[model samples]
Target: MTAAAAMVRVEGLCKRFSVPRREAGLRAALRALVRREYRVVEAVRDLEFSLAPGERVGFLGPNGAGKTTTLKMLAGLIVPSAGRVEVAGFTPSDRRPEFLRRVSLVMGQKRQLSWDLPAIDNFEFNRVVYEIDPVHYKRRLEELTALLDVGEVMRRPVRQLSLGERMKCELVAALLHGPQVLFLDEPTIGLDVSMQLGIREFIRRYNAEHGATVILTSHYMEDVAALCPRILVIDGGRLRFDGSIEALRRQIRPLRRVSVRAAALPDDPTAMGRVVLREGGRLVLDVAPERVPEVVGALVALPEAQDLAVHDAPLEEVMRALFGREEAADLGGAIGHAR
Candidate 1:
């Protein structure tokens, strides 16, 4: 897609950093002071993707997989070493004021709001920074507060609020201007399950109402499952998988897991499927997708079978297997994220 038509567009994106190599120990530190050994690290390489307005997509990867680097580039916080990035019709590296006004970046590791003030005060500050009219700001604030359920605690000091409460207010502050695009980097980190669910719901509602384009990077699989229909998976500073969540599940791990709770132990669990896990009265089997129905039928017909359930393999295991395959094959080619 061209830059003008895409909410976000990237072509041959790369970000490289030179780092000083130093070993742990007083002698090594002292020696490195006079003569430093430098190493080039590529955070992102030849990355290309585009997003249309109102699309909610998840960015997935292990640590050091360039997720944050890509987000920072899109947010215009840093310039790429090479390549192009246009967000909302403006080149992010240019740091255009108009582009900044139409988007917001919420990073779990960083806070844009003042630490010493109440969340309401931060929201008011954003209103002034964005030059929002008083009437419109008030209306937006009311709507966000109602949606996030932060009405009562808006006046409370941000420092005193729990992590989850602070996260909700942080979202309100970031969104006070009604940004058209949002870059969320681990927005639900460090929150309880209920609070995480609330944040996920708020994100979905906000996107549905405003047609906001959202790029979410989160470790919680459930958050991605609930919010993103599509996902971009990166590994070792390169794109590994980009497609629907189901497609990723199928490509990385084609097997289905069938768990059966049996009334008694079977003479041979392998007859049903490859025994993956077994305990007191429960047997977990890894069966090919095509064989899942057959295996389940056979197991259900067994006299000892009590109950059976089938599920796709866990995402963590899929990723682990993917990386393992990459290591064995040594294939570092970038995978394009298709719309």
Candidate 2:
């Protein structure tokens, strides 16, 4: 999207942190204390990307490929070391009231609700803090609580609520003001499968119904695969890939997985592709894209072929292939420490 038309615009974005350096020994430590040395660590490296209004995009990266750093820059929590960031036509670091009102941030690992108070009370506090009109606040609260099934949960003390309940309340608080841009950082961390699914569906529904631009970061591959159509892959504090999940899967792992279950298994399965799994009446292979149809036909012709399936490589595998063992380990360490 063009800069003028984009809801979020960034160029040459970078973040550098000055870290104190000291030796291990006591004498060295004392000397360092008197004359402390510093080293510059580049956390985000000349990143460039933009998001259109109402678009849900994901930032994919190892532990600390500057995903949170970039989010903070966009949210105006911290200023970028260099480059320009305009969200809703306002620079983030300015922390202007207008800009803050236009955006909302939800972090899974953190809590914005007061632990001792009921979430309903906290919502009231937020209504005042965000300067939301009483009528609009009541309407939005009812809408969110009903949609998330959190009407009763919001009335209980936040500390007494289950993690799922608390997360639902968090979502309610974040959306009560009708933000145009929603930034989510690990929005579903440490929840059961059912809870995760509920949260996932809620986010999708909220985005669709409100048309809020959603920028998300999640360690769970399923979350990104389900929520984001477009993804930005970052490694070593730099943009690596930007495209749809299907495109990423195709680019990183070209093989198509074909599996079949037959009463009588094939004698020469290797002719089809690389054998991934083999057992009584079951065979799974990684076939080339062009050979998938031919292989599927052959497998289907087998006696009593009961179950047959064809799919691209899983998202986890695609991500593993995208980063090598040694390189990802090294970068994960340095970037994790920096973040």
Candidate 3:
């Protein structure tokens, strides 16, 4: 069997920032000037991972967890304080034209297009920057316009476009060079549900058609569920989990949720499972995964049963539990434990 190639590789990767220490009073500030005070913050700590070609992976973390910092390292925006990192056969810190031409970074909070200029103008600018051929440029523009459903908004000034429209144009600009790898940070932030789903679908189709490798950091769990098959969750400047979504869910929330609609529930439903909810003739229970069949059996045998269904806990709930557990572990001084 042929060994698979990695699109990105990172080993012992670390980033540190020097933060100044300030005092409340003027006297303290004056004393600090004579002898400065500083604190070193470790943003990323000895992280090691690799991504195979065409893999769509979610990079998740809480605020200050270094999700964006790691992305910047991969995008060549910031150099790592320690360790080795490479993307598409190039060290991102080197920022070679050839290497840069093969990857693109789209930061939702940052704008690549000029605010007063039409969105199409930004595309033209990227074409020159990447030195794309005119034929290829037009073809890519047409394809992205169709996929993102932004053909009509392309000619409008960026300032005149809606937030959703501007986001679509940004995606187009990022892809104008036909990069094989994409780094997306908070891509769906601030968009309505309909627009978020639109962006999600477009990204899915683009990945399917082009076999591009995507590494995304999104606060929206729905986006992760819809687009990423695998997820790498980081917390407290370290990787907590790295695996398929199913595996992560199973590891953190092993219990299954079984809900039933009936005329009435048992007097003490906790005997069967912990009652999750009871309202309007519906009953929800959290049962051990191994006992789901037994619990559902008892519910099925009830004469008042109207309907029954069993499923894993919602991804958001699972993730919350995971983070809570991680926090507890950190407080307990078990920082080396892997999820």
TM-scores for every candidate against the unseen true structure: 0.94, 0.92, 0.92
Total backbone collisions for each predicted model = 0, 0, 0
Poorly placed runs, candidate 1 (over 4 Å): 1-4, 327-339
Strongest candidate by lDDT = 2
Tell me the tens digit of each residue's lDDT in model 1 across 133-241: 9999989999999999999888999888999889999999999998999999999999999999999999999999999999999988888889998888877778777
Model 3: residue 87 alpha-carbon error in angstroms = 0.6
lDDT by residue (1-339, candidate 2, tens digit) is 678889999888999999899879999999997899999988898887788899999899888788999999999998999999999999999999999999999999999999999999999999998999999998999899999999888888999999999999999999999999999999899888999999999999999999999999999999999999988888777877777888777766789999989998888889999999999889999999999989998998999897799988999888888876445433322321221
Model 2 bad stretches (over 4 Å) = 21-32, 325-339
TM-score of 2: 0.92
Error of 1 at 114 (Å): 1.5
Residue 266 in candidate 2, Cα distance off native in Å: 2.8
Q: Compute the lDDT of residue 268 as modeled in candidate 1.
A: 86
- Screening candidate 1 with a backbone cut-off below 3 angstroms (N, C-alpha, C), the clashing residue pairs are none
Q: Lowest-lDDT window of 10 residues in candidate 2?
A: 330-339
- Cα error, residue 24 of model 1, in Å, equals 2.4
Compared with the true structure, what per-residue lDDT tens digits does model 3 show for residues 137-221? 9999999999998988999999999999999999999998989999999999999999999999998998999999999999999
How does residue 211 of candidate 2 score in lDDT?
95
